[model samples]
Target chain A: MTKPDVLITGSYPEWDMQPMQEAFTVHELAADASATSLPRDVADKITALAMKGHAPIDGAYMDALPNLKMIANFGVGYDAIDVEAADARGIAVTNTPDVLSDDVADLAVAMLIAQARDMMGAEAWVRSGNWGTQGAYPLKQKVSGSRIGIIGLGRIGHEIASRLAAFKCEIGYSSRSRKETPGWQYFDDHVALADWADHVVIALAGGPGTAGLVSKQVIEAIGPRGILVNISRGSTVDEPALLDALESGRLGGAGLDVFENEPKIDPRFLKLKNAVLQPHQASATAETRQDMGALQRENLLSFYAKKPLQTPVNKTGKSYPR
Target chain B: MTKPDVLITGSYPEWDMQPMQEAFTVHELAADASATSLPRDVADKITALAMKGHAPIDGAYMDALPNLKMIANFGVGYDAIDVEAADARGIAVTNTPDVLSDDVADLAVAMLIAQARDMMGAEAWVRSGNWGTQGAYPLKQKVSGSRIGIIGLGRIGHEIASRLAAFKCEIGYSSRSRKETPGWQYFDDHVALADWADHVVIALAGGPGTAGLVSKQVIEAIGPRGILVNISRGSTVDEPALLDALESGRLGGAGLDVFENEPKIDPRFLKLKNAVLQPHQASATAETRQDMGALQRENLLSFYAKKPLQTPVNKTGKSYPR
Candidate 1:
């Protein structure tokens, strides 16, 4: 009973930590630390592991925690987790999704408009005392009423499309199959969708099947007047192709929340005046992150109560429904 | 026939300049030039003056252009022109309003989201290579579903409300008079509206009557969690009260387009991380500006054609409808 019951591998907000600490005997491990470095007593008693968005947790990590029953993920996308491995070991995996959709979608729209309107440059013009000395920032393209192509019509994509729709934008999308949605035009191929759209947004699931879905060909089809927005995983877009296109002025601009090998993202992107860079903070809003932490805790509480997991991504040893 | 038919007193997009040159014998004057500075021959021949959003055209300026029959403004706000002065001289006035409403409203929404999500800091965290080292950015408030209070219920405000509606935000407004709208909560006092709202957006017209409408009391009522978004005019807000609140952490943050002494904005704002500054580019979108130019041209052309004006904001002598 004295051993810590949970391991919070990734960090959460300080406001969320107090409640989490009160509810469970929690042990925290630094995000950069390997699981093998965990103290034996702490690892032996750990029943659940809490994770944020970007961390690779495979079977080897699972083996490090012999008694681990569930992985409570703080974000919607669980692509970084080896769910198949979790399932094979009868370990339940749960993720926080719907709670963060509005925040993520709001951010996607914000980034798109910020890029198209030259918000960053406009701000700089004012902050650098240039507006008085030089002149108004140059005019930028309007985001409203443009034909938008959405890649992957999943929950977050749908939310982004819905918000943009209110701006009177025409919606088009490329998903694996034609969805029941009637207003949005669907394309079987990403390239065709890009060609048809004035703007393209990457919202596909991030996994082996969807990696590099927005290829060089697809980006080229988007053309110069086109803006691209990505609120999904960096793996879903061709980072090198995207960088080249943006630098060469083949693509109009980008509003990116993710990047391949992010944090250590290509330094070339730093010099780009056309891109609006965000550190994968689509669901980083305090309101949404708090909700996500609560949901993660909820899942853990449900598992301990012997109830079907709240948002189970995979089935686990007789605890979740098959 | 020897008279200059149209005098362009302000700069316009090059795309608009070509058409004006073709349609009429044009006399161009620098925006900085006082009307009296124009050569007497040139000033005497001017039949109509084309104006942009800024650059004052007072009675003295109007008095200089004796043959000026009309003033066709390139922006929705004709506040820069002394309408009383124009009317006394029987000068017809028209403005480009609805054409740029979507673009302005789109910008207001974008600024709000960017401020709430800390897009600027997040970008720096990644570009400066801190995301890998510092872990993640601190969480921020969510924009979607927050109670948003608009200071005006005019066209741009209505447009902003419609777009935010899709994000599921609860909309409230304070206007001169309550409108026929049903769902939005109405508070006649700006202070009352701020007290109830999580965020307040300024959409009120800027003028002598509307100056300092967002007073110290109202801004304080919005409190620490409330964000202020201003797209309307710098005069509408109490800039010093706002600056003090933001610096003291009494008010949460701000997304400002217009400033009290813009260009020469308060240097304190540049140091605050809680601000998103723009150089009044709400309608500075290429599509919208082009459309505005076309509309301004249309008004000037209509005056020349003796047709009922397109968007007459005020009337003049025998040529305009009484």
Candidate 2:
């Protein structure tokens, strides 16, 4: 039997690509590749799209692949993919979630402690012979028993709160609705949570509706002694407001894993010693990434076999006409 | 009555010093200052010593302060002060403990996750615009749900284990005796624990008895895939063997907060990319340090009042001649 043709719409690890090449007729596109980048014949043949990164997949892009029945997103956050558009055209959308939650939560906690304790500064003190020349590294604030306000109580947010509880942090969260957590305080307003938090971690989903969820008012509420950690999408936060707060010491510090225009993040972030910047790598662990790839492939295989999708985000009422 | 004369044997934070100066006749000495550093008249008048850092306080050194009755150490570890010599001379010795355990544990967990995740490398990628110029930071190993071995299960070690447990790590420990922990595996031997652990943390107290406890064999047992985190004294591990392993990739990585000759640590440690070096700052936080200072002072104040010392490490049967 002829293998089904699939178009990879972003840069992926070689581990994911190698096995995928063996099971399917694979076509590649750059992470920023447009519909025009593909030949007319190849675009017509692609029955599925394996997507990664933050490149937007709109209705127009989906229309190019006429037979495309499914989009298997590599990571948990599928905000970049317009689920409404995919549903309108009967394209089943499946995201690799739960698998990457542990890794993301681990990073959220790591960044919180790293920034709180100034791990990089302390490392530099030892490496630069400053411990010998200068005295001890300047004392920083303690992380244990501090008030932690989680901006969203989703899977990733819950995981972060669970880990921090062992550190004796008082956990509070602001979500659309209350979650069944063990005595974690819930807030209806983002600004209220930020005001109460010694540290605030952003774990909300991204998209137009949630854009600027952490607004200027929220940033101001997370006062000078407060640390903001964002492991979620850059769209969840107001980057300019965050930058201004960090620069002026209006916000204590930030441990950001994502930013607007990431990779090419605002140069202002580079100057602030208070921010712990990272290349959107919360789920960027070899073990977890491999698992993610396997899950992504599983969804693709299910799509071709006419079996039910494993973890679909949107179930279209109508079947694909393929 | 005239204020009791007390000599501060090491440089301390102003928060600690300010209070000490107000209550007592404060005499200053550098961290590395010796008996000869203090004027003979001042040494003769000194009744108490407030100590910090790892400066040796031997029997001969103690004899110089003819009126010295007690020594109050700033940190949890009292190995630097000769307790045996103090006992012989009937000089009361006290150290601040329990108060700094949370901060030390926080750093231990921070360093463990930092090294495992290569947090410094990731931050550098963002800061140097490598994330934009190159691509994603290289994938690291997953820290959550890994097998962790705690070498000592004392107050600080227990705290570290407790925090890591929330990260979903399988906790194993090697202590002289088994602790009543909730289902944490216990190994009687250090080598066995190292062999079993994905990561091993050394939290044993530093002294002659426990010196070089994490031997060359233990380092070898931890193997190439294992990471070592030492928040305990540097004297516990074989530094030469550790360096060799780190350089050769026989050991995966290390997160060191203490070293044999810190400040002037072996130049080789500075060269290893796999090792996360810190300037012995496990308990160096503003809130914790303030508490430590208060505890140390409480012991000193009790000593001058002819009351029982608050946190004495050595019980000198005889009262000081002073």
Top candidate, metric TM-score: 2
In candidate 2, what fraction of native interface contacts survive?
0.88
lDDT of 2 by residue, A1-322 (tens): 8999999977777898899999999998987878767899999999899998888999999999999889999999998898999998888898998999999999899899889888888888889888978868888889999999999899999999999999999999999999999999999999999989899999998888789999989998989988999999999998899999999999999999998988788899999899888899899989999999999999889888887777788865124223
Query: A241 in model 1: Cα distance from truth in Å?
Result: 1.1
User: Number of clashing residue pairs in every model?
Assistant: 1, 0
lDDT of 1 by residue, A133-243 (tens): 887788889999999999999999999999999999999999989997757999999999999999999988887889988999999999988899999989998889999
- Extract clashing residue pairs from model 2: none
RMSD to the hidden true structure, all candidates: 2.1, 2.0
Docking band of candidate 2: high
**Can you give the lDDT of residue B293 in candidate 1?**
92
| Global CA lDDT computed for model 1 | 0.87
Interface RMSD after interface superposition, model 2 = 0.9
lDDT of each: 0.87, 0.90
